[model samples]
Target: MSNFATPETRFLIGATGSIAVTRLPEYLGALRTAFGGSYTVLMTHTATNFLSPHAVGLSAERVIAREAPEDWPTDKPSRLAADHDIVLVLPATANVLSAAAAGAAPNRLTTVLLATERPVLFFPHMGTAMWRNPAVRRNVAQLREDGRIVVDPVEHADRDVVTGVVATHPALREPDGVVTAVRPALAAS
Candidate 1:
């Protein structure tokens, strides 16, 4: 693909289930504002709990989440990789990370994660305990080894009454951080 060296205007976003899922509109707004491109957001099945498919659909050119009842077009993943330059995963949960590390394609998000040949940026989000888990770290390391860009999470704690531990605030909150990490993927044209 001749376009691999430069940035692309069409972005495919893979969002997972996390409290951070609610901030998608803000993130998409900033990216669209700064880069002037179209956005397509695909939410993991669990993600729909926190964000509405219709609402996300309103903000983006298209929306496909795990909750979508109809099967995704089987050919869309490759078509997407061909047409879009960037693939971003925000709040990449441990389960999804594990699935991606193994190259599993049981669902649309993981399928796109594996199928896309374009730059894939992952912003991992989870509780400190979960993030620190050995399995999670190994998966993160593996994905990074495979060339994914991971913007480190910041320190923000909101205590859970049940868990009594703080969950992280994903870097996705700062659209600037996403833009910063994506610049390398778009350096030339």
Candidate 2:
């Protein structure tokens, strides 16, 4: 067990982009089981297409979606930041990575990121080609330089439906793996 695996630890889960967002329930359940901590979920507009806020709420103390500012549980991003111990951007899309690297607050999730002094962990998920893109590589480097923990996505074999050809792609780490990474990521920072 990790030293940080305490009941009082608070986790802010920022869900971004597609596919991997569908596994949020599993992720939340794993975190709750591993750390016995409270969880709050913040979703990007695109995340809504993958999973509903109510689904996320089933495992979280609070759920905030970017499109529905009226449903925000906190008055400001800084307040939310102050309340949480760490920020985990799961399924971090290239868009959010670029935005964070540039210090742009174009959305609610990014706004909270900008306000938080907490350790930020990014678990990036994208195609192999996109993950290897020059701009994406630069953004990841910038985020690391800025003191954020960016976990490299694991390689997974993905099959193309049309061609029936298998290709290795950058995939989100399993929930347990992510929970395990958090400790070292925090310790390093």
Candidate 3:
């Protein structure tokens, strides 16, 4: 035998389009520092609207956006996916969740998800209404059934919601949350 338990690990982080994109710096920074592992960030096209690719990159040219050149090879994702130990999608959008559940790989991020057998941990972020939408709920159920892990977002009353009718939920995943969730998974893998 061979034991899968190993210390050094590699991570593939997929950051989706969500306002929580702004806080990724803190969480990702912590994961890189505390986890002692290298990570590559694959940002969705819309995610760039919230933060620049350079900012997400830190010092390494490890960040790749969805807007690849037309000449970029179609098999790039599989080649990249083969290198990572796990896949974690932070600020995962409702649309992304649905697409993954529906087996739609429109972008490199989803392509990586499909092309690899690596474990996936999805941290979904969206408004309360969107989170509770029938389709979104259905997708979440399907994803869970398919063996994808999720870190549930906390719901709180938004300052703008004076009536408290709907809670504004954001997946502002802190560094501690990332470290806590990733450590056990990394150890097992």
Candidate 4:
């Protein structure tokens, strides 16, 4: 391992089943504009549903998709943490938020979340009702308490229903050198 400080930062974009996935191209463009030569991106399966791997791969200058161990040369574990500095989960869904809060690592994205020692940033997007759910609230609270950066979503009228709440705007700026540490909430019996 190299002893260099401030290795080039790569973004791990873990998107769940949110409409926000549709905006990936813009997000990727923004990231490229901001970080350009300094970032690489990895995408989640659900995100691929909205955007093609080729598009994201072209934008990031590398392949973008899930990383499975069985895939071997195609999906190496090291790729998630290799020469990277941070993991940012944009459009994080309630399900993923709950999984992270519960320390579950069932899928590739969640598994990467568990493996990365770098700072984690979560930008959650979902219905206002779901955001306010006790479980989601607890998860958000826990993630915040655990030293993860949780960016607040901007509320707006739902395009689908025309009256209900939805997350319309994105939190775009990237923070520098933010670190969050997690401590167990309770002592083991």
Q: Could you say which candidate leads in TM-score? A: 2
Ranking by TM-score: 2, 3, 1, 4
lDDT tens per residue, model 4, 1-189: 112222354556665666676676677566544444344556667777777777766556565475555666655546566545666676678888888888898777787777777777777777767878898889999998987777776655445477554545433222221111101110110
Q: Where is model 4 more than 4 Å wrong at Cα?
A: 1-7, 67-70, 161-189
Summing lDDT over every window of 10 consecutive residues in candidate 1, give the lowest-scoring window.
1-10
lDDT of 1 at 103: 93
lDDT agreement of model 3 with the native: 0.78
Candidate 2 C-alpha lDDT tens digits along 1-189: 466556778889999985889999998888788777788899998999999999899989989885566746654687888998889999799999999999999988899899999899999999988999999999999999998989999998988899999998899999888888887754553
Quality of model 2 by C-alpha lDDT: 0.87
Query: Higher-TM-score candidate among 1 and 4?
Result: 1
How big is the positional error of residue 154 in model 1, measured in Å on the Cα after superposition?
1.0
Error of 4 at 103 (Å): 1.0
- Which regions of candidate 2 fall more than 4 Å away from where they truly are? 67-75, 186-189
TM-score, structure 2 vs. true: 0.92
Which pairs of residues collide in candidate 2? none
lDDT of 4 at 28: 59
